[model samples]
Target: MKKINRREVLKKGVTLGIATTGLTGLMRGRAQPKKLRIGFIALTDCAPAVMAQELGLFKKYGLEVEVAKEASWATTRDHLLSGEITAAHCLFGMPFSVYTGIGGPAGRVLPIAMVFNNNGQAITLSSQDFGGKVGFKDLEGAGKAILAKKKEGKPLTFAMTFPGGTHDLWLRYWLGACGVSPASDVRVIVIPPPQMVANMSVGNMDGFCVGEPWNGVAVKQGIGFTTVASQDIWKHHPEKALVFNNEFFRANPEESQALTKAILEACKWLDNVANRRTAARVIGQRQYVNADPDVIDARLQGVYELGGGLGRRNYTDDYMLFHRGGQTNFPRKSHAIWFLAQYRRWGMLKEKPDYEKIAEAILAQDFYASVAKELKIPLPKDDMQPLGGFIDGVTFDPKDPEGSIKKYKVREL
Candidate 1:
């Protein structure tokens, strides 16, 4: 990796890194770039980028920004690759998938920052099958319910936003816990979040794992009921991030760091409870999620509605996290390890990899740490280590990663 001379960067107000060799360095150092083009699909998860742009966070951080509303995740990925957009509010697994040549680009893709962790995401089941809410206080019960459904000679068809995305992993993990082999027992398909309700209503799918707004719409329309929340499946898992092409980072290191700082500031602003209402309103506008503020606000403020009529008025206090005092964006190697383990377990990665090396190469924890320090955010001595129960009834920790992967009885890689 090329190193940026901090003193020189500070003096010049522009990146003079390894990529800017000779003539290019001499020519471009005279002026700063005017605008940063950011691409985003219209989803509630893209709120931070919207908020950052609306609240002047980008401008406050010395950036001229263009917020490009994209039509699809594929379009956003393409824009990033073609240098049409500087960065994107992208799927968490997108960079990984691209880096490993599993999706999108056939080469490496890098993400500058993780946007948020754990939000209003859920797996919803069609109400055509069950008129009332189905009870599943435990993973065993959920599993049995799926088995019973399968035994009825009708297999469950589920949808996720993108293959290898957070929704995909959560849906797979939840199903795998229920003893339903995602590959065999259930037909898993990739459907954009906005189209989930239409697909379910059209009978193309029986259920779907998706982010908010769509889930809320499905419930409000009485089409389906949410079976479980993502938190219930795996609490506080990393969800989405600001993804970029690796070449973009190589060509613009200073711009990359500046972008990270701008985003980090934006995250802090969003987490302020006082600003949440405004954040919701801004994100709910047509330019962003293009949904009702009430629907968006319900989930943003911890008011959850599990379809078929379930949930407290204010269910979870911290459903979506921005920055947990440096806990939010810093890419922990262990977190990357967990994702890799899941990939292997789900057959996305066909082999047990050199987890440490992959984690180090792709996660960019060191870059995140440096940016955090530059912004004066309090850095945690170690990444978060939470002891929690997974839907599969398996326990996990950083120390016993292999054991954790092996403990899942229903894992089907």
Candidate 2:
């Protein structure tokens, strides 16, 4: 008999193990079948999921992943609800929004597996309005432009990707800080991220808040300019998450863990800075963002063109972060409660829903904790860290959700 190499032996053993399951396994720590569908939007932060597939990280963890590019945030949410995608790179607030009945059909059980990234999203205003006159730190100028347009009967429309999504909350907070009522003083509408620039270019909106590459794309087109990045609203704020439908999470515990491990590795790879240019190239491909790699890489590197002749600004401290030694991927329940409080602050909830209850259900800390341990990732001391670093002065206290709501002066409620 011919002697077999160690590599061949290991490969054959793995093949036999998979063949034993035969592409079928029940939930709860059992083997998962191949082609687990994962969804992502065409924004820059989708890099983690894309990279997981491209680098074979998913396969490394015995997960066969199909990274599906979603058309809109709404579509992504629908897919999550329908279980068409087992997991997704999702807005951190979206699962909360759906749970609270503020943005979707309501009572949907999507569990946030981990935070996909933080910061690097932005608020962009049309060149026709505040392009040269306003930039980051010029909310007063943006306010004035809104007033001028209001008097002129244009009323200065604004757009966000989804109601109660991260973009919506940022627009509402920024508008409120500008002394404009999001509910009454200005009309805020919903548009998908990829379509933000196109809508603004045809005189459809005055400003929009969306994820990157879109903001970068706008600058390249000269139709709109970024006023402030989302990090400007709250530096190092959580943006997107690795969210899975709760059914998939609860039923397939071990499979969920393996997939999370894969993405966590991918996130660590992305934060290396040297790989960002390569990431930009891969994610900017036609199947993903379908935008310019140079445009995408510029912002990924903290280099911004700041169009409308606003000049260049490089962010030394806060750019989009995927994994800063595992801090970026930890899904905290406090952040979930913070989003719930935003719904309360804006009176999106008829009566205050149980914030803690909702947060506990939606944020999969226990699941995340198990995966972090396996990967030897350091977890934060607590999930309930006090959130600060706002352009506005108010800090969110997870201990006092209602009190935090009252602190926002421009709130609808």
For each candidate, what is the lDDT? Answer: 0.71, 0.84
List model 2 lDDT by residue over 1-413, tens digit each.
23232244335442211111211322234455577999999999998888878776677667778889899988999998999999999999998898877888888889999999989999888898785677666888887878777778768789999888999999888988887888776788999999999999998888899999999999899998888888889998899999997788889887888788778877887787877877787788888888999999999999988887788889987899988877888888788888888888887986878988988888888888877876778898767878899888898999888888888878877
lDDT of 1 by residue, 29-63 (tens): 32255698988876777777776676555665557
User: lDDT value for candidate 2?
Assistant: 0.84
lDDT of 1: 0.71
Clashes of each: 1, 1
lDDT of 2 at 104: 86
